[model samples]
Structure formats: C-alpha cells, structure tokens
Target: MSGLAASERSVRPSSGLSRFAAMFGKELLELVRSLKLIWVPIVFIALGIMQPVTSYYMPVILEKAGNLPDGSVIEIPLPTGAQVMAETLAQFGSLGALVIVLVFMGTVSSERNSGAVSMILVKPVSPASYLVSKWGAMLLLSSLSLLAGYGAAWYYTGFLIEAVAFKAVLSSFLLYELWLLVLLTLTLLLSTALRSAAGAAFAALGAGAVLSLLSNLFPKYAGWLPGALPGFARQAVMGSLEWSSRFGACLVATVMLLAALVLLANILLRRAAAID
Candidate 1:
C-alpha cells in the first residue's frame, strides 16, 4: 500500500504536465495546418521591410517633388530613425494584431459549432482546460508572428540606420506581443459569447475599432480601457519614460479582460453541457 501511494504521487505531476502538453500539442498542430498562420508572418515581414524603406525614401521623394503651389503647399519633415521605427511598429504591429484576431475568430466558436467541443469533453478534458489550451495555442502563434516581425525589423532597420539600439528594438517588439494577447483575450471572450464564428469576429472587430477611436480622441484622459493598453505598451517599448501610466493601465485592463473571459467561458461551457 505504501509503495502504491508513493508511485501514485510521483505519477501525478507527470500526468498533469502531460495533459497540459497534450492540450498544447493538439492546438499547435491545428494552428500549423491552418493557412491563416501563413499570413501572420508574411504580413509582418512585409510591414517590417516597408517601414524602413518608406522612412528612408519618403524624404527624398518629397524633395524631388519640390515646392508646391500656395494652395497645395505642405511641408514634409524628414523622419528620424526613432520616428521611422515607431511609425513602422504602429502600422505593422497593429496589422499583426488584427491578423491574429482574424485567425483566431473560429478558435472556440468553430469547435462548439462543429460539435468538436462535445467530443473534447468526452476525452477527459474539462472545458476550462480546453479553453486554456486554445489560449496557449493562440499565444504561441502570436509569439512566432511577433518574432518574425522583430527579426525583419532588425535586419532592415540595422541596414537603414547604423545607430539603432538593439534593446530598444526588442522592447518595442515585445510590447507588440502583449498587445497581441490583449486582443486575443478580447476575441476569446467574444468567441465564447457568440455561437457563430462570423458573429464573434465582427463583434471583436467592432469593439476594437470603437476602443481605438475613443483612445485616439482622448489620449491620457481616457479611462482604463482595452484601447489604451496597446498604446501604453507601444510607448513603453519605444522608450517613452513617461508612458508608465499607460503601460500599467494596459496591463491591468488585460488581466481584467482575461478574468472576465474565464467567467464567461465557464458560463458558456455550462450552457453547452445543458444543451447536450
């Protein structure tokens, strides 16, 4: 009896780890097999290249255009290396976030719709565990996409500007990943709330747009909201020493969002089981 108990204890940890791994592995396989994963890297790489190239050449292009007539006159300032990096990050990083959201549009909703959620439940997996595994898978994919963007940015920016700070560049890139998680959490909540994949995606996109518009209009004055979080993260990674408030606010909001999603997911799973 003593030997059996000892063996059981030793096996428990390994069993738990294996379960998490199994869940993570299943999601990973699905992610790789999906064509949407292909677009994440491609879009980010394109943005990385375009940002530096555009920054380096925009001034020259404007110079060639020369002075315009009084009615059409507009001054185009030469973009500094930092400014270029910031602009590039904003455009490409946001694009990457959107791509991640779209790719994950069906993460949970599809499973529920296709009756795969029911199948998963029969396999000794709890709904919470399944949702967590789905989140883990999305996080992994987002990390890879961000890495691609970071590598491309480093190569292009290093070539374009000799004095670029590697640490700063990395921080900016990491911030982008956090932003990805924030959006992913928001979408996860929507996926749980909506029965249709299209409905979830549209709801998430609409919420994202509204948050963005509000943040752009209010800046520091805006309350602790999802839209404010990404901006704070971006500013911090960009070495904005004064952006701590924004970063903190974003982090806090992200945590709250995840907590809310956990509650919602549980409710959905209960409802699903009831229906079954």
Candidate 2:
C-alpha cells in the first residue's frame, strides 16, 4: 500500500504538469483571440521607438515649442544611448505598466465570476496549475512585449544616440522586467482574491504607488523593496550601480515577494473553487 501511494504521488506531479501545459495553451489561445498578441507588441515597439527619436530631436522640439524671444537658441544636449534607453524604460514603468495591469486585471476574476473556473475545476485540475497557467501566460506576454519594446529602443539608441554597452542594456532590461513582474504578480494575486476586476487593478496599482513612494521617501530602509528596482535598473544602464552591494537584497526580496504572491493566489483560488 505504501508503494502504491508513492507511485500515486509521482503520477500526480506528471498529471499536474500535463494539465498546466494544456491550461497554458488555452490561455495563450485566449490572448491571441483577444488580439493581445498583436497590439500589445505593437504598443511596446511604438513606445520603444518614440524615446530615442524624441531624445534625438529634443532641441528641435524645444525650439519649435518654446517660442522663446526671437532667435533665442535652445541648445539642448543630446542624451547618451544608455540614457535614452533608461528613459524608454521609464515610459514602460508608467504607461506600459498601466496597460499590463488593465489587460490582466480580469484574467482570473472574470473567469471565476463567469463560472468558467467552476467548470474547469470539476476536472482533476489543481488550483496551483490553474493559477500558474495564468501566470505563465502573463509572463510570456510581458516578456515578449518588453523584449520588442527594449529591442526597438536599443536599435534606435544605437543608430540615433551614442552606442550603449550590450551588458548594461541587458542587465537594465532584466532588472526592469523583474520590477514589472512583481507588479504583475501582485495583480494576479489581487484578481484571485477580489471579485471585481477593476478593484483588483486599483488595489494593485495603489499598492505599487505606495511602495514606490515609500521607497523614494525612505531609500535607506526601503532599498530592498521592488519599487527600488527601476532606479537600480537605470543605474545599471548608466554604469553606476554596484550590483553585488546594491541589488542583492532587493533582488532577493522581490523574488521572495513574487513567490509569496503566487502561493497566495493559488490558495485563494483553491478556496474559491471549494466554495463554489
């Protein structure tokens, strides 16, 4: 009987993996059907390209807009490629983050409200699989969008601005991506816990804002928070951050918080399923 039980346990993990893959496929299909696969990347690319172009033409733009005293020359120094890339990331940190939050805010809550989760849960699927599947889909979308955007920015920065180091760009990109992932995880957790999609989005955004404010206000203490990631990412791009001393604590804390969010999401989803 013990051997049989052990065999059953082993089989469960395999079955769970299969279920997760199937669910992840379904989530991807849904995203495609909703036209996210097409437009999200386009938006990211657009945002990416705009930064370098805007930076390159800043003097002209300011001259045209400033309407200074007749013949007043506006000699704005052009930003370096790395600075342009960092500014592009700033755009993503704000508008891009909002787009992502709004897009995924309804990922699980809407399905649960529509009884789709109940239907799916009637099968042998585990709540962890369901939540993880949603997370996987979100991660895929976010990564693709970020890569497209950052790639565009990098190319333009090299062409229009000074060339940035590949290592700096890569490190900054990953660090910024990590920060975005933290926000996405928080949204997913809130979506699983709250019934209203708007509420989830609002709560996630509010939490992010508060964290960022606290990090800015108390940098000495809140340096380990995920909110400090963008600053660290910018510093990396500018070749100023000491990764070993500056990022270690924040990286560990951010990852731990993300894992905790995922676990909480799964548990909340499981309880919701049980209640239904």
Tens-digit lDDT string for candidate 1 (51-156): 8787777766666676755466446665556666777767754676667788888888888888888887876667777888888887888888778876786677
User: What are the per-residue Cα lDDT tens digits for candidate 2 across 1-276?
Assistant: 999999998766556777888999999999999999889989999999999999998888887887688878777888878789889999999999999899999999999999999999998888888888999888988989999999999999999888899899889889988888988999999999999999999999999988788888898888778899998989999988885654788889898999999999988988899886
Which of the numbered candidates is closest to the native, going by highest lDDT? 2
Q: Which ten residues in a row have the lowest lDDT in candidate 2?
A: 10-19
Task: For each candidate, give its TM-score against the true structure.
Answer: 0.81, 0.93
Model 2 residue pairs with clashes: none
Supply the global lDDT for candidate 2. 0.89
RMSD of 2: 4.6
What local lDDT does model 1 show for residue 230? 54
